[model samples]
Target: MYQPEEIRILIVDDEPSILKFLSLGLRNEGYQVMTAEDGLSGVNAAQEFEPHIVILDVMMPGMDGYEVCKLLKDIGNVAIIMLTAKDEVEDRVKGLNLGADDYMSKPFSFQELLARIQARIRNQFPHMMGDVQVGPFRIDDRRKEIRYEQRVLSLSATEYELLKYMVVNHGLVLSKATILDKVWGYDFGGQENIVEVYVRSIREKLEDREHQLIRTIRGAGYRVDLP
Candidate 1:
């Protein structure tokens, strides 16, 4: 998974205030952020920065967001979120039709924008987002690591795989057979009891002594439930 610092975001808006506001807020969130005053500069920045996400404004003087979005899509696989002063359905549809991944109206809540950014990354560019946040866990597949509440957990290679599998499939009840097949491979010659042992070890590391996070589903196997 990619860390926030590893993820690049480009903010393109003619408005100075919006640019400053977004740049500061996104940088505070730890992303590598760049700003562009208009659509043309935004495209230039996208080419140089190769940002994973772009927050683009629709009404620009020279090129406008639709054209820029189209060009960006042609250039690379970027997740583009369009910002428009008008909240009309037609504007939203136009942006989407031009390959914008998401749309936001002006005066939008910063928190809501942040949520949309995370959602786009989760849905569209999962592999590029670095450390992805699934519930309370931050999974970094690249480093083969997991962090709970910002603290990195010490885990072995197999332990990491088991925990990552459980966390990725957080709500489902994973049976021993399924876990073994997915994590240990289908041809592994281990008994089902092995899943239980690893689960206990992972729970200890997670400090889930009360069995709150990872729970035993009786006749079923184990499930990871985030509080």
Candidate 2:
């Protein structure tokens, strides 16, 4: 089991209260916690602190979360959880599209936030560490890479996790709630529609190659059919 003290978390928010509150809670949980007031500082802290996870606020004064997410992604291998005050789908989608591992709307419970952080960390270290071949899809868990029909897929961490889960459970219809619990972690506290957004994104990439592995069972959820 991984210890909380082994994990370092960086919290980036413009609000002083949020920073103090989250920092205190995370520290109490035994995680090494760091904070930054804005996106630029967040980027700097990411480089300096080398945290395993980052809690980033979306609506900052300058250099919003989307841009910050992109920059951090370029820095590589760190998990990001984007925070947004609005419940707009576009904002969430934008964050995910920019490679954020997850999103939490403002006024979120610290318990749920902690759960998300733990879930993301759990995903980083899977019990299985090799490649999985299911139908036309090949998943390299160690490298965090996926290939379909001899072509590589450019997937965000969340998208890769969702696809890998579906592939592992191929031929079974997985409900949105189950996917959320398994892929996004339990009690994610976000709308189930976020699953649809990621599914569509994966479909657009996979189906564009004229290969359709994921099947939608209307009113049920989704399944990846074996080729």
Candidate 3:
């Protein structure tokens, strides 16, 4: 029942029920739907699908949603929505800290998914506005410019999103999942290698070099905190 909409979507969940249900429902709504059962595959599917949005399961076997999210975000320009059973604020905060675009709790309804998808579509068309300042980086939405130390940084669409997401979540020890969700959105299902690429790109673009900013959290993901 997939509609004729131009938007493509990816749904990642460990549960077959959730994945199939969402895929069916979303397709019926005029979107091209793809799915993945595990975090790693989800990343691969995302890249191939080139989805407009990614719906991620927070808890999954093999690498987990958080890690997948992080890797995905690192690549750039995808919208991520994290769905989870854990309703704790910490979990929510963790997802947000990682840079997910939105979140949903488990047992969510089809109607809710439709609504969320609609919103994601709406986001594709923007209302150009003022700049967003985070740390030393300045995002000029109007000019589509990024400045660090008065030096303009050139970026691809994905790179812009990656940097913006990181700066927005500064001071948070964001996991890859969180960053992926925030920057890439849930719709991107592809290899996690993209995240690494973008982070490296961002580091070269933003990091002062002398003072290390984007630091790896060992067991966690990445962080950009001021000293």
Candidate 4:
């Protein structure tokens, strides 16, 4: 996975002070963060934020951390570290039982919490945002490098991003809009043809003229599968 610098985190607690402290400390440690001061609000923020990690407090008004954690698990498998004064064995057990990846007792040092969250994220999505291999294609997510069959194909930065995006989502019929959204970010003006242009370039550079992995879906955008 990418380092803490690129990781997005959510810190949820009723205590504004703790939320502020963790947010500052996590940001200083090179992680992005969003905070919520209550349990129900935390859930809603999580839905919108799509954070990589969530720091939750056990006691909160309305929903509480356990319920929030359970609800998050149902939505998706996000790394969760519970932060609370309830340090009893049963409390820890309950937190883990509720699908928390880890827990931190209150009065926690930021160093420990940050370390635990990083480790948990690594375990969850080790290859997606990290060095990865899919068939003959080798990907270095950090440096944004890719190679096929030991040959490095010359690619422009956008072309590289587009190709890497396709390989990462191999076998998915990704629409041009979806590709633009993920690779070009939110500011991409309407330019659907840009995707078609780059996809064709990637095909020319990465594959032999005889065999190609990128397939046009007629009405859809593209799909990446082994040739």
Candidate 5:
């Protein structure tokens, strides 16, 4: 499992007290936390810091949460939890439509927010959480290891990441570009064929010579399905 210290959180709010309160609380929980006073700064920090989750306030002075949420979704893979003093259902729907993963009205309990963060981490990035099972493969995130039918599979660092990414997103026919962008970061200098090479290596280690575990889609990328 990923330790809390490995998870980065970005909190953006106009209120100084709210920022301080959340920063201290999340820090105490062992999360790597960063704060921004407004929507613009939050977007800037997300680009530089590349936080896993963004805690955004809806009613900011300029470039409200809605706009910020749109821009953030365009930027990279990030889970957003919106905060608002408004408790209307319309407001919640609006946030969700714009790509916020979760929402919380003001005056929410700190414990509840903490729970939501954990939930998002599990739901959106299952590979980062604790043990996960897909088909006959079991992933131990804390140990950074994978076992197939109780037999440990030797995997290099990149192979481990690629396999975990595919396994966590089981049953999805991931495109080559998408896999490259997600596993190898957008900044990776290698060619897209690198994905094919890693897939071959992982398949060999999994003893999937028949290509049942990680199957390549014709004209698409690949998929891992539960049996």
Candidate 6:
């Protein structure tokens, strides 16, 4: 079992209250917490503190969370959970598309936030952690790398998670709701179209006319047909 004390979290929000609240709450949960006021400072903290996970606010002054998320993704393998005040699906999708591991809207309970953090950690570092080999695809969770037929595939964090989930459950049809729940966490209240977006993105990278690794089951969902 992974201990909370072993995980370090960075909270990046413009709102001082949110930073304080989340910092205190996460610390109380035995996690090492760091807080930053703006996206630039958050980036600095991420580089300096080297947290395992980052809780980022979508709306921020100067450098926005999207840019921050992009920078962080490029910088390290830190898991990001975007926070938004708006309940818009576009916002959630945008964050996820930007490599955010998960998202949470404002006025969210601390318990829910904690759960999201833990879930992200678990997904990133599972207990029975090992690489998944389905056909020509190799999903490496620890290194966050994917290889197809000896060629490396460039995938975002969210894309890697979705692909790993499908590869782990190869030959099984997975509904959009189930994909959302597993990959994005149960706190996701956005439309199922996000799954379609990620699926298309993954297919573009991993599939071709001759090798169709993923199949879209009409009226059912999607499945990764292993060779």
Give the per-residue lDDT digits (tens) of candidate 4, residues 74-190. 998688989889779999989877888777887978777766775566445555457766678877756767888888878889987888777756776888987887688769787
- Model 2's TM-score against the true structure: 0.61
Instruction: Give lDDT per model, in order.
Output: 0.88, 0.85, 0.75, 0.81, 0.88, 0.84
Which of 3 and 5 is ahead in TM-score? 5
For all predicted structures, in order, the TM-scores are 0.59, 0.61, 0.55, 0.57, 0.60, 0.61
| Cα lDDT of model 1 by residue, 127-174, tens digit | 675677898889886687889999999999999988887876677688
Q: 62-169, model 6: which lDDT tens digit per residue?
A: 999999999999997888999999999988888877789888888898887776775566566553345655578766666888899998988999998898878766
Local accuracy of candidate 3 as per-residue lDDT tens digits, 1-227: 11337677889998999888888887777778889999989999888888778999999877887888888888767888899998899998888667687789987877977766655543442222256455576767657677876789988888877766665556667777656765788797876667877888778766546437888778888887754
Ranked by lDDT, the better of candidates 4 and 5 is: 5
Per-prediction backbone clash count: 6, 0, 32, 0, 2, 0
- What ranking of all candidate models by lDDT puts the best one first? 5, 1, 2, 6, 4, 3
Regions more than 4 Å wrong, model 2: 127-227
Better of 2 and 5 by TM-score: 2
Off by over 4 Å in 5: 132-227
Compare the candidates by lDDT and give the number of the best one.
Answer: 5
Estimate the overall C-alpha local distance difference test score of candidate 1.
Answer: 0.88
State the weakest 10-residue window (summed lDDT) of model 5: 118-127
Give the candidates in order of TM-score, highest first: 2, 6, 5, 1, 4, 3
Over 91-111, each residue of candidate 2 has an lDDT whose tens digit, in order, gives: 887887788988899889999
Candidate 3 shows a clash count of 32
Report the Cα RMSD per candidate.
Answer: 9.4, 11.3, 11.4, 12.2, 7.9, 10.5
Q: Would you list the clashing residue pairs of candidate 2?
A: none
